[model samples]
Target: MPKWTAADVPNQDGRTAVITGANTGIGFEAAKVLAARGATVVLGVRDTAKGSAAAAQIVAASPGADVRVQRLDLTSLDSIRAAADAIRADFASIDLLINNAGVMYTPKQTTADGFELQFGTNHLGHFALTGLLLDMLLPVPDSRVVTISSVGHRMQAAIHFDDLNWEKSYSRVGAYGQSKLANLMFTYELQRRLSGKGKTIAVAAHPGGSRTDLMRNSPLAFRLAYKVIGRLITQAPSEGALPTLRAATDPNVLGGQYYGPSGLGESRGAPVLVKSSAQSHDVAIQRRLWTASEELTGVKFPV
Candidate 1:
């Protein structure tokens, strides 16, 4: 198989994309490349200032780049709704919706909506966002919903329906894992709903051990390891964005499939078709999560 890189990203001319957390790290890298390839990219972010700066950088790198910014704080439902409405107003047909923004192992906290921080922002937030804007994607041929998961989905990952918010007990790593696992489950359920539609698909991806500020919330020992050995081993943000880009635009990609690194242990390498945890493929859990998410977020998909 050939090594896949940003260079392999097919032409995105005339495509419209909305990327969450597009101001930095993996999102920024994906936005930059997409914009360079002629897509009208919107940097959906919580900070408009940082988002504008990122848009400026992209335009500078690729003169004539059609790039802009929008406010999107996934921790707040209002912010996500406003962002989706604004983007929908601008583009009736969306080619790609990259649900990429997320939080890692943070000190226990809840979102503005009162759900646990990681599960809320990483899963429910994107769930609501996708539900709100799915109409814009359904009619567009080859449209895709690419939600970013993580290698962590295989590490300590489980959906605790009894205490989804982790209000009873909290473990930072465990919460993060649950959130990422929900991402995969959501994609599978979404694809099932999208089946036979032919025009739209739901896909997932994970950046294998990339060096990004997302790890700032990790414990002291893990942080120290990233500062030393992890730094030497992890892939770059551009490389980390590969799996996402492939999932978003790869012509051969199927709905319900996942993408990650091709290297050993899937830690770092070019993007390739990957498998998520078996728990992530549980249909009952996926259906349960989909229904619970709709109830929690008050957002329903057009499908």
Candidate 2:
């Protein structure tokens, strides 16, 4: 099969897309492409100022791009609820919910709700947000929920059921891995539930070492090394966003499928169907994570 690129993204005229952390990087790139393709794109950002700026940039570039901003700080449940409520009131139905916001390897910290920062923002926040907005997408034909995972999921990832929050011990790398793994599991479990239902589907994708600001929080040594070698290895944010755009807009993509770079080590090339870690496919763990998420966030999926 030929390689999939953003050029393959179907026309999104009359579609409404909600993307989180779209102020910059691959998220911003994805939002820009969708807006250019005629989707009314809503930037769900922690900083409305940044979101507005991003929307303005898109408008400047696309001429008639319809883009808006919503305040969404994934670290707080209240913020998530408020953002969802605002989106619900303004939009009658959503055609896409792109769970693209995330945090990388940061020092041990917790969210406003006391959960680990990476897991809370990367996995749990998106989980809650998807549950809240899924109703709108449920009835729309070909609507999709696309979540962004990462290659890091394969690096020291395991669901620490004993300490899901990493209270007993803390390894930033392990925490990030756990959260990313949760992303894939969430997509798989959601696909299972949405199967044979309406047109809504759940898909996941990774940027594959894309050059983005997400790695700003990594260790200084890694950051310094990346500065020297990143240009040689990592793809641009536009290139990285292709996997996500393909997952969100590719008509042939099925629910529960994943996409990533097609080059060496799946790190830097055009987007293509990709495989996740074996652990991410564990159905039992997926259900358990779902239940735990619902209990933690007080959000339930209607599906």
lDDT of 1 at 33: 95
Q: What lDDT score goes with residue 113 in model 2?
A: 99
Model 2 lowest lDDT segment of ten:
1-10
Give Cα distance to truth, residue 6, candidate 1, Å: 1.1
Q: lDDT score of model 1?
A: 0.93
Off by over 4 Å in 2: none
Question: Who wins the lDDT comparison?
Answer: 2
lDDT of 2 by residue, 22-41 (tens): 99999999999999999999
Clashing pairs in 2: none
lDDT of 1 by residue, 114-199 (tens): 99999999999999999998888888899999999998997788999999999999999999999999999999999999998658
> Candidate 1, 105: how far from true, in Å?
0.3
TM-scores, one per candidate: 0.98, 0.98
